[model samples]
Target: MVKCNTMPEVRSEIDRIDRELVRLLAERQTYIEQAGAIKGERSAVRDEARIEDVVAKVLAEAERAGLSPAIAEPLWRLLIEKSIEHEFTVFDEKKKKIASA
Candidate 1:
């Protein structure tokens, strides 16, 4: 881990990490869109069972990463909700393309 000696260094490191985080998020979004394309119904976008499964997985990963589950759980829940909305949009657009074809 890189040690920071000043506020500027800390802020710079955080900015760098945030950029990497966004890159990872974009990669995750591609898979979410792929799931939308594979599923037949918009109703499938919100899978409660799968959500719990994901939460459990994230909790475990958080423990491994030394992150607090208290924080990770809520953050992931929001991410999942937003991802579902994005998936729905992708599904609708694809359906429209197919119907028009």
Candidate 2:
């Protein structure tokens, strides 16, 4: 990470980071869609145990990466929630297509 000498430099770095974050999120979404397709049932889309496991793993990684739990925990929870919602949508769409075929 470059040390920002001014507010403009800080903003520029933030913008760059935001772009990278979006790209990474898009990649993650692809896997979420694949999961949607692979799961056998709609009830499997939201796994409580898996959600907790993911949160635990992310918290551990955040500790190692020096990211504050305050930020990481809620951020990941929301991200997971949104991903599950997207997965549910994908699952429904696939099921609809299969039924019509």
Candidate 3:
């Protein structure tokens, strides 16, 4: 992290971080879509055990990284929820394609 002497510098660094985050998220989304395709059933898309495991791992990493649980926990829960929703959409679309074929 770079030390910023001005508001513009801080905002610039934040903008850079946001762009990087979006790139990483897009990469993650590809894997989520792949999981959707690989899953044998729609029911498998939302795995409760996996969600808890992810949250636990994220919380541990957050603690190691000094990020606040108040921020990390809720942020990850929402991200996971949205990812599941996206995976469902992907799964359904593939099913539709197969059915139509």
Candidate 4:
């Protein structure tokens, strides 16, 4: 929604889009939680290649939408890293079970 003309007319629309991103991130986290449950004792919660795939796919969409790919990449990278951390914490179930045995 960035005004390619540098006008403020598109600012509100951009803000709306940003809010949508927040909601989408929340939705994505819910799915990540489910993935953790399904991983079930696997010590590794993240696949780096999968993250790369995500970034690549998102960047492609951004480009197609005429948004700056540069702006999107770092934003998604931070999101992906946070997801990995959240998933990894739950994966300690495997570690704990191994230790207690």
Please say which candidate is ahead in lDDT: 1 or 4: 1
Cα deviation at 13, candidate 1, in Å, is 0.8
User: What's the count of clashing pairs in each model shown?
Assistant: 0, 0, 0, 0
Each candidate: what lDDT?
0.96, 0.99, 0.98, 0.81
Per-residue lDDT of 31-93 in model 3, one digit per residue for the tens? 999999999899999999999999999999999999999999999999999999999999999
Candidate 4 Cα outliers beyond 4 Å, as residue runs: 1-15, 93-101
Best by lDDT: 2
lDDT of 2: 0.99
| Ten contiguous residues with the weakest lDDT in model 1 | 37-46
Worst 10 residues of 4 by lDDT: 1-10
Q: Candidate 4 clash total?
A: 0
User: Model 1 over residues 4-98: C-alpha lDDT tens digits?
Assistant: 99999999999999999999999999999999999998888889999999999999999999999999999999999999999999999989999
Q: Which lDDT tens digits does candidate 2 get at residues 1-101?
A: 89989999999999999999999999999999999999999999999999999999999999999999999999999999999999999999999999999
Better of 1 and 3 by lDDT: 3
Model 3, TM vs. native: 0.98
TM-score of each: 0.95, 0.98, 0.98, 0.71
